[model samples]
Target: MLTLTWRRGDGRCAFLAGMLALLCYISPASAEDGYDLWLRYAPVGSSKVEGYRSALGNVVAPDRTPTQRVVREELRRGLAGLLGSEPRFRASPAGDAALVLGTPASSPWLAPLRHELEGVGEEGYLLRWTRLDGRDALVIAAHRDIGVLYGVFHLLRLVQAGVSLDGLDVSEVPRIKLRLLNHWDNLDGYVERGYAGGSLWDWHTLPGWEDPRYTDYARANASLGINGTVLNNVNANALSFSPAYLRKAAALADVFRPYGVRVYLSARFSAPMELGGLATADPLDPDVRQWWREKAREIYALIPDFGGFLVKANSEGQPGPQDYGRTHADGANVLADALAPHGGVVMWRAFVYAHDVPEDRAKQAYNEFVGLDGAFRDNVVVQVKNGPIDFQPREPFHPLFGAMPRTPLMLEFQITKEYLGFATHLVYLGPLYEEVLRADTHARGAGSTVARVVDGSLESHALSGIAGVANIGDDRTWSGSHFDQANWYAFGRLAWNPYQSARDIAAEWVAMTFSPAQEVVRPVVDMMMASRETAVDYMTPLGLHHVIARGHHYGPGPWVDGGPRADWTSVYYHRADRDGIGFDRTASGSDAVSQYAADVAREFNDVERVPEPLLLWFHHVRWDRRLRSGRPLWDELVHRYTRGVRNVEAMQVTWRRLEGRVDAPRHRQVAAFLRIQRDEAQWWRDASVAYFQSINGLPLPAGEAPPPHPLAYYLSLQFPYAPGDGR
Candidate 1:
């Protein structure tokens, strides 16, 4: 087990005492403290205040735009808390110790560096600690106010991370132009696939009284360089466009504006008839186009910087242009045209699957989208889910990543633990995000990574984006579990720079959110790093995906079948039979592997060459097939499941060692969750092995524990009202 010891007068003890004092003094009545997130610039202890005070002594912002005003205010607020004194605001960099914050247009002193900043783009910024007029100053220069806002957060992060500000020359430009957060929140408080409690936006309480949580939400997004948020669920409600609801959305837009976050709404394609009282909502109809134009004008009048509409048309029974014999592009173009004059873009989701059962579900998205390549308008972005299927615990990166070079594609990742054990499971999603981002698409060549496609580096598309379905809620800790917060943090960091490693991100987050002490940080990060794989091993190892209960996706359900739709059941995905186990995505069967690039298809198509991690996803091997590791396929599968359970047991041991390292409330919360995770892990291993072994006619390994109950009992388990199902 991991161990943590704190001696008197040591840094760990000092930091612990400081945290205790802050917790005692800080009243709970402040701004739904849950919303502030890491951006909370609460007072820091005296010992660490001197360096920040000396470095960031004064602020000099020249621009007076609303966004610029927000940048200035944030600097002042953050400095006051960290340095214990509000820095002086200067008109220019005339003072010896001033910090100049502005775009090149606002600050003439940065005119000479315009050449250097030319390639950085409108959203990029340059921060330097160079001398100005013989005075030591920090200059944050960008091409736009929003970029300056991002720079301010970056500067503050450096201070928080304890980096030396001297001789700094940091210039950063976002690879993706549109960094967005997709909330699966409905008009009602329910959030689909959301593990955290109900939605953060209290729709019942609106325009009249703006929640301070809204402002704090914006602050958190700004701190992570996330600039856009889609306010409603992809399974959209037309009522969001009602005049009353528009006012509520406008109120949120006002709060987020200061933090450089522009609000985007999920639009129901049939809103023309549902809300506008039109005879038809067809995209080809002239009246439908006119209705959208009028609606766009109405929405923009209330919120000028409105990012645009996120549409989930013709998927999962949602109405769309297809109902009227129009293509996906036809639906998006109509909306894009309406928002074009106002500089808005339509985010058209490519998560569509025909209601008709297909030979292979994984190939549906790629086939549909590849045909529509270059058919979309310049302002329309195709949003593709990280994996083709609904947020499974483990999935190969979607084939759509490299198939459509002409169309700008945005990655949609789920931060919520829909398939991974929900709020109670200690599954850190950093590695999951990294795995997808680092996947080699091989679209252009060997170097064609999914990160390049997402960031617009591969295709050179004008607009690029990466969005995470938020896990945020009314929970005091923001995310339901304390460690779950890292998923949110990891998503933002990856969205900003997809090249960042998950391990590094975890280390940084652990240091900031908890303690930076080596003993505490090291063990905590190790647990986090192993957490996701452990969940995968115990839940659905060897490329076996979507084996959860039918409705709530709670416990094991390998016997689950006969759902309203075949695709919704666990048996439909795994396809295990007495003959053998695993789906056949190879050419001999579904040929789903052909959807990938030529090289990827070649690798996946061959049984011998297919990666062991994805072996079951592509081919059905005999139970006794010999693995490269010399274990029979059945034995290896059981071993993986048992290893997963053991890993969770180890994590429990690791966490127990840190009893005094974290606060009593958070420590106990995590301990309780770990206990739940261990129980569930065992449940998963037993249930899965029991059901699969029944099909393969195999016995349990000599030392492995037999399943606790009969296969019927595990299959009979039910949870109709699980949270996040949005029933």
Candidate 2:
């Protein structure tokens, strides 16, 4: 049995007061170290302090797995900060009012609960306040050690979010079994679509020296129930497989292990030739299979729990089995076999397009993957990006979600703001994520949402996963701006529980990051909720997408054309002319809607039945075509673009009034960025309207603002050094 003790000024109450004092006024003191994140564990007032202390008298965590140790350390740290006293740890949970945490293997008391936890799976956990041996105690139980770690973090989150822990019967299992982050970071420190700064993984200084930031990074992800991270860009480098780089990755794996995060690598498909000196990297060849199996063994030897490969093969000129006239399933299954012995899975990316293929870019992924639906290995997951096209401001969910029900499909959402104005625009992607998640694929009838597909409930696949393209960088706030942090937060929360409402996630984030005070939280949550729609309205309202500047995608470029590939040009997507606009994906054209369920196909195929938000995405209407709004297509387009600009201007006003409510530095930074968003929103509206009006010869509607510059001026404007460009 273990004894428990609590000291005054040793818990969350003192820590909160300290942080409040530090951030009260803008000075050198206000510049935070940022290690706190949202888990400052700050001191509560005397009124609430005793309740927490009395409730949490001691800790008893017997599980000795690396992940369970992390949970124990976090509890100690959180209690120390919040209560201002370090709680005693007991060898067993025999004492009254003790906190018991473990898997069945570690805790005899939890052994009886194994049958109840059987449905929870390996990554699920249960937290309950129950009486044991005539004493009140808190029990955190799981089927596996990692789940116990997650349970601890969940409990801490509830406390930080100011929820009552009494009568807590929390049983949480991740909707998506594999929650991972895909970092588009290069070996040279440049991040693809990364706007914050250089990559967090400093390869030059790794293998021998480990940055404390790495641990904190793992901690943050663990807190959000994210369990894996792909440590390189999808445009992979072959040299990442070299022994030197492998050793560096092993070091990171060591740090991440305790936090329940397994490190994964984005593998270059030609690694057999580039790294192993094979003449031809054929999946069917004996030498190629042996090489991959050996490489997998080597990696597992270095880091026992390393997550497997994420491959972007035959996509955007990357090497793949297709290079040798082989199928995608053949390529993925080879690597999957290699890793299968070590209990690893392969995440094969479906973000494929080729200029040589004379088809709508949106239909390419579904065309390729659906053909080989059940051919993939059981351990292979097809990672499909949220939209068929690259992460645009607004796009219909990818058609592959329902098309390939036999294979496990993983949802790949971009947490990085590649199209929606990067980190500058105050767009909270929670609503955007929700929109896609809730979209009824109608594959398994009416209730078959995309979330169900991702969570493996709709198709009942053995393996399920979701990956977010991370936006984290070397910036002080982790993301470039402070509010952008909410996107990262929201991704983790959604990964944990796919059914959670975006509005609810936004409110929780606002209270944790800014203030728990209702007056301050309500306005901020409202702004965040409206932000994604505002960007869509101004930039690509009514399903218009990919109209940004060529290559950089910084501002509007509706006039862009004649790129190396027609698909790269903005004109290819919008297809505006004197007669009509929008890409024809109906029966008269690509017939991409046929890839979806029968009902969904009919709804999208018909011009009248298609939702107004996605009207232009599927159909091209004439300049004078009457919309549901009782306005012509041209006037409605202009109205939506103008309305988006006004919405951003309104956001600027709302942010300016929040000066004193938030810390001065962060407050000022958000205010300044909101100003940038407003200006850029206007630029988007002006450039798009001017270019479209030139093509259609339509007069501007009354009360709509004309372009600030001529069509030629907007077309000539160039952003050679824009951030997040692949180059």
Candidate 3:
């Protein structure tokens, strides 16, 4: 019954009007282009609208601070779109079902609940359906304005999900200190291993003209509790450190500040020599350290609350301390010292290997960092990939995870489907992330999961963090495909609480993105749940890793060899010949198994004790070796390859049934993508079988057909212009 007695922010009203106009003109068939992402804020079904409309018809919120203004405007936008009517704003509670949102310091009525707010940290929030001033209301209270904003998003999510608002008492706190997105976008607007269209950061036009899309990007990330973003490629580009680009980055930082998202830059280690007029870029040199300190000061002056650097030093030809014969800890410590005064931290990467072949490429990172366990500064976190190897279709947990008890290691997951199927495949990475997070590292005693290590619960470290190599781009859907957005969403949710179920996350995303109807939600979530397994089955079945075609990594390449480094070739990894396939990391081979805890190492070394899923990862067996399935190793391998392609077929069939259920545009795009996936999966199965057959000289398993083409034919087929491929 109450209406706004005061004016809204002039800038906010204009922005909303323009955005609404844009939405009005979007064609129905283009709905799945994904510009709206999970924040579509579409109208709820008639059946559920009555109760929600009554309960949330009016809001009692004050817009004093920037964050507070964002919270109020978001409520207006979301409620108007979802409930099909603009909610009235009141200075005080006027109706029995009005909404109340504020920090304890701002609201005298919420002062008594300050004790309750104390439980949730600075980034957490509390939402309760309670009575205020004798009128029943849904109260969203937090310790900080940003927390209040997060609470607002949560309330809108409930409406979007068609869930009941009755007795809603929810409290959420982020388990990790830093939940960040590492964007591998370069200065030239191209992204490394990025399947999405183009870079989101338009540096040429930034610090002068602000794009409206930037605000939308911030909102989407904020809605999912993502708090930080490193805005350039890890492959160091010194040009990004120039004054002009700093201003550009500062412009982005300003847009993201109110949403609790801090901006960090991927500081190229050789920037001193490249941009600072210095000769030797050594961490041990005082002159080199001073140059970095001055650079840090300049960056902090431009963006006061700028999150610190993400360094991928001395790896893959990127300059680092190793060039100066210094350890990773030394490089990280110097930067950490400079940033310490500004309350910043350095994220030093641990995806290291000698350019020359070591005993095994997988052992290099663990060998390098484990020795300097406690040498790193307290503020320096070692950012490590989820798997020991590069972002393959499937890989075992990185050995460095539990090895560094003295240092905090942040889990870095690739959200982009570089090796998976690149924008065209319907692969959900939720299960992949879940698999890594839930894996038992057995570091301390029983329940020492990789999740515990990342959250700092295992080592009792105060600083904990997780980073996802962002799949976000300038594409209409944000990510290249409609489904890939789920990976970004899943990463944020898991980074907030590693223990959350991936299936549950997919369910929530399905309901909010497609429709709240159970008919739509159930089947879509079911497809997502099985997607990653399907990808692993088809692309790299039975513990296979990194066998994609050379250069672009486009297709099957089990026969690929003669690369500059042996580790870069598929033959080095698969080791397929008269013997069976798989890398042997057990004691007799690379001895990578010894990097893990005693119990884990023992299990990995014993082929019988190892899980069959990873049979090929840790052991190299003969073709005739018998598996627990009572089948020969070669037959089991073939069965897995066939199973993978069959799963893709099943997914295609499942998606086809939803022709009329989902929006025509997104539905059409997804259907097309599913078709592509099925074809590609068949290609992978056939190509892999053919290559292995040439080496093993064995007959195809029973009921298996010979590949349609010879190995030469498949090898000659090339994708010279793949989307994410480097020229």
Choose the strongest candidate by lDDT: 3
Number of clashes in every candidate structure?
A: 0, 21, 0
Clashes of 1: 0
Task: Name model 1 segments beyond 4 Å from true.
Answer: 1-36, 40-48, 91-95, 108-112
TM-scores, one per candidate: 0.93, 0.94, 0.96
lDDT of each: 0.86, 0.87, 0.89
TM-score of 3: 0.96
Which TM-score value belongs to model 1?
0.93
Residue 297 Cα positional deviation in candidate 3, in Å, after optimal superposition:
1.1
- Ranking by TM-score, best first? 3, 2, 1
Query: Which one wins by lDDT: 1 or 3?
Result: 3
lDDT of 2 by residue, 609-678 (tens): 9988988899988889999999999999999998899999888888888878787767777888999999
